[model samples]
Target chain A: MIRSITQKKTEEELDQLLTGIARIFIIGCGTCVTMTHTGGTPEVTEIKEKLLKKGKLVTGDLVLPVACDNLTAEVLHENRSKIDLADGLLILTCAFGVQTIARQVKKTTIPGLDTLFIGKETGLGQFDEICTQCGSCILGETGGVCPVTSCHKGLVNGPCGGTKNGKCEIDEKKDCAWTLIYNRLKDLNRLDLMKRYQKPKNFQREPRPGKYWLTPT
Target chain B: MVSLFKKALESKKFVVTSEVAPPKGTNLEKIKHHIELLKNKVDGINITDHQSSVMRYPSLGGALLVKEMGGEPILQMTCRDRNRLALQADLLFAYSRGISNVLCLTGDSILMGDHKEAKGVFDMDSSQLVATIRKLEKGKDLGGNDLDGAVSFCAGAIVTPEANPLEPQLIKFEKKVEAGAEFIQTQAIYDLDLFKHFMEYAEQFPVKVLAGVILLTSAQMARFMNKNVAGVNVPQNLIDELSTAPKGRAIEKGIEIAGRMIKKIRKQKLCTGVHIMAIGREELVPEIMSAAELG
Candidate 1:
């Protein structure tokens, strides 16, 4: 599950940001961002209408079914003329999607959305952080709970003697991630997994500018 | 050699220790004073590892200083800042430096600290950290590779007797015991009845339990902790006492509250001993012990 986040900026703010550029191309993602209503056909349509009402030209608009996929390159190429018609582009997608599309096209891309964190959809219109994207994965040792994201202190070795009534020390609303992990492991009878001391994470694996590409088949 | 605190754990008598959060900067004068004052009064001095995820002088360095100052040092190791490699190396260093006692804890989240963006390397949970210490004692690393020499430790872990939904905390506590934690220093406790209930189950395990006592300075402090700090509860009476303290004597009232808690824990034989967390009030430990009749 992907976490689709919305920025606090409004239509007026977006209009203010596009001061000079009359003709604009708007792009949104159908997968993650669409779910958040921040980057979808509806959102793109809304922005296009607002721009038209502001007397600016709405050159083109497309909500790529999936913007972060390898196929984004092909999609950008397919929509090249529609995109080239605009003076600039407004990307209502995550950083990953914006950068992915930007690399394929040479047009100046304006990020209309704020990229939040990697998280899971907790409920309808609700999301919570689940993974930190730390280079190394240790959920096996933690009984499938991601302490990196769960603990307020993000303590991997956890609970930190600060939890009260199974809730976090810092946030009373949240369950203590360690306590949850412990209880989960106990229920699974896999508490033995918690016995192994995890060495420090090899952050080098998830260094900044992280990129990966599988060899062509 | 086994540390004196280790001996106390093995013995039936109650054990007493206190925390000394190392300075944020290089100024060691304050910690040095706390250590010197507490050296003879308590069984061990726990050097916290960035206590609330805020960066500070290393616990390993503080443990070494405790050793130098003639205090039994319990080096607290958290999996927050260091990975397994750094953790193992620090353990080896602690053992080599003759700092024997260890308190294994899953450290506080880095978000709670000054550095909000720092990545947490919870490579190991507290249970794993405790088990790792055992592995080191067996002269081997986690990879099953033999070490240059064997290390001996008086290892311990923390427990929250005051935890709501106490079942999960108990589960973790039991896991810590199975992972080789010989002693447990509980989170700060105020309600004695709650601790008594926790101890009823805790006694079945083969581990020592030290009730944690955090010195309450004021009603505001108590309210702040209740709201902000997890696993901590300051009874309304105690808060009222702190509020009514004459002028600047609030600290004295706090001292009395801590001393009184220690006295009751000892009087009731609550568990093993008391682990006093005076927060920044380390100098008042001797007085606390005196009032508790521990001196």
Candidate 2:
């Protein structure tokens, strides 16, 4: 399953973000954030305790099963009185969940975690970014390995001169994406694809602020 | 008209080029001195563009300075700070100013630089940047719009000759050639045997290859590059020789070693030319040239 990988904001940044808010209702997610240990029930309870000790009023807290789902509105309505007593909603979830909750509530929503990337759980607890949704997909030629998201510079033609022993220059532990694609293509007898010249990417296909509709009125 | 650098490459002579890095601030005194010193000695002088992603004086500005000082300037452009529109606009500006030589590079990662938080705008890779240069020469913009004045450049790209798993780097080298790279200035090479092997394969390409020779200041620096810098493998013997240099004279010994390698590369006709990168030690380029018997 695609997961929203995230990391908690620094204590200094969080303090600055919540400087004006005194009374707050904490909300966490039980889905992606829960699995990532970033924003779950225990995290919400811990923040509630920390905020209480910092001389702020923690009106209430709740860990919605799926904070980004349409059912989030009804779950928040169940605890309206507790939520209404707060000046802001401290959302300990991914950007999707935080935005979902913000639209359903009138309270000022503050994100506690930074959404790093939409990734896949590659190992027990390891997540790797799989795709960047670069509308003109080249996976068909790259043997199913997406270089746009994997290569540090997102070079299309081939690997930069920074690859050494199948590792990227940025970090020795990280696998060089081109080497991976090269090996995959070599195994499938498609090494000719490695020699093909990829032209300059057309950024118009997936313009920034990407939007799409399945059925237009 | 072909650039002087291109003419030198075509002349089949043992061409020599050295680089000058722009200072961090507006004080261009140091670079000016380096340019004046190398103007008559080397075939061309290359100006670096925020090398290592550390923000510094612009390479375009430095290249103009080289031009003003009556030297052939090879402008280095990286796909690290500018988007396609900005890159194309800069190329136009560069061409209009008569800076007709360019070296396209896939710059170092922004995370490796001083400004760790700055966004890296790698809108095009080096090969794509080379292709864009070709497109601009044909009187069209990246958007396929007609241009009143088309720009022509003796555009070049870089390759890591000793890059591990050499096939991948070779592939990119070929793509750069296909994209209209007329010459290539390779990554700093310390091992000649490995470079000969790379040249054996690179000879098939139509592009001119200039072997990169970076001056080693000390044994420690060589070891650091071996351990930290990617695709740079300084043989153990070179390190031992640097270590053997009497205290404080390691730089002199380093100069000897660099001169020796350049001499061998020239004697063997390993490639078409040599690009000496005296990183921060531009004054010693003349001495390196002298040591190589090219002076």
Candidate 3:
């Protein structure tokens, strides 16, 4: 539920996508994006306003719940006239949502936001991009702070000597992943837990195309 | 007798208020039940205007319901969807209906709502809306057009006390007061220490301020909102406390935490009042108030 702001395409990039299109329709996803305040209706409206300010012939915009789910096809079917009236579709959703719209519509499709992996909020309006979808989650151990995902250097066993005053070598304000893990374990009075060295993470199922299962089917 | 809110502010006693989100559909039974539960417990009820850009029953309609139910209603208005003409007309209509208190907001982005195809008419931001309200009070429209009759309101606006680069928010705070805002309601404040720091600067101003208190349902819920909701920050320690509660008892724990915060806020007199946003859990408002000994 960490509602990280998705990286958006610059106006120059958007201008290139809509270069010659006479009319463009923007679509936003409501379920996840709206709740996160990232790709929801507000971002779509802001995008539409920005495009209008750029003199683009933007036709209109629409937001659908679970744009990657089957419901999007139904929404597309319902709003087909508006979608068909436009020369191209600008989608403000995750990568899955963009692909879903592409599969459902015949018009040219473009992604307004670059999909990033799930992140956790560290503070207000601040997020730490963790879990590169390494295909595995090891939150049970390590007291919830992911050394593999959160550490910029990805140190699994211990903090590198580069860590100074608990801050990461890569970024000054960011806490070293190992340092945070150490402090958290210490607070729980379980500092000895670090003696159980975890092996280097396996990449077989991560950063690669693979199938996942909720239950054996 | 004068309004309880006016009296409380005049006496410098910490007052308590709460918000009621109108149901999306026409069903008013639940809303009415909530109003009855909170009528004597709180000083006023804020009727949110399509909060988070989601379309629901109008705030004006909810305010009317509050009026009929014998509760003072603070009508919230956002400028995102309405033009000045519509806004002014709505203000006039609200005044005629005996809705005197108002909280002006710039509004959430329309793109955040279910209706993405809806057009946004940001003819004015919150500051301009406050200015517009002032102009109407002066018997003039925004364009110097004279009005047939002047309208009066107990005008207020919102301030995000936790906004980073606090200068801009502070500047806007001063601008709102300059535009004739009589009161200010802050965004949901979790860290009172941070709020104290904000008040250090705010105490110099001449307006009554209200601290917004949002009820936390669960640790996971708090974490979710901290991650997702803008301008809301739930400290990790508070989340941990929420997580430690046994199943089905988290709501009670939340009420306890809110009660504690309210007690501290009242004891310190950090602000003129407290505006509680329980999200959809309006029933627990009285519990928090009673726990804080407000009644």
Q: Encode model 3's per-residue lDDT on A35-143: one tens digit a residue.
A: 5576788899998888788777777789988887888899899888888889999988878888889998999998888766677666765666766666667666677
The first chain of model 2 has a TM-score of 0.97
Residue A183 accuracy (lDDT) in model 3: 71
Reference-based TM-score, model 1: 0.82
Model 2 root-mean-square deviation: 1.2
In order, candidate lDDTs are 0.84, 0.92, 0.78
DockQ, in order, for the candidates?
A: 0.38, 0.84, 0.02
Which portions of model 3 show Cα errors greater than 4 Å? A1-217, B1-4
Which candidate achieves the best lDDT against the true structure?
2
lDDT of 3 by residue, B173-287 (tens): 7767877788899988999999999998988988888998999999988988775565578999899899889998998889999999999998988889899989989988988
Q: What is the per-residue lDDT of model 1 for residues B84-113, given as tens digits with 9 covering 90 to 100?
A: 888999988888899999999888877788
Candidate 2 residue A20 C-alpha distance from true site, Å: 2.8
When 1 and 3 are scored with TM-score, the better candidate is 1
TM-scores of all models? Answer: 0.82, 0.98, 0.59
Q: Can you write out model 2's per-residue Cα lDDT over A120-181, one digit (the tens) per residue?
A: 88999898999888899999999999898999988888998778799988898899999999
Q: How many backbone clashes does candidate 1 have?
A: 18
Candidate 3 displacement at residue B265 in angstroms: 0.7
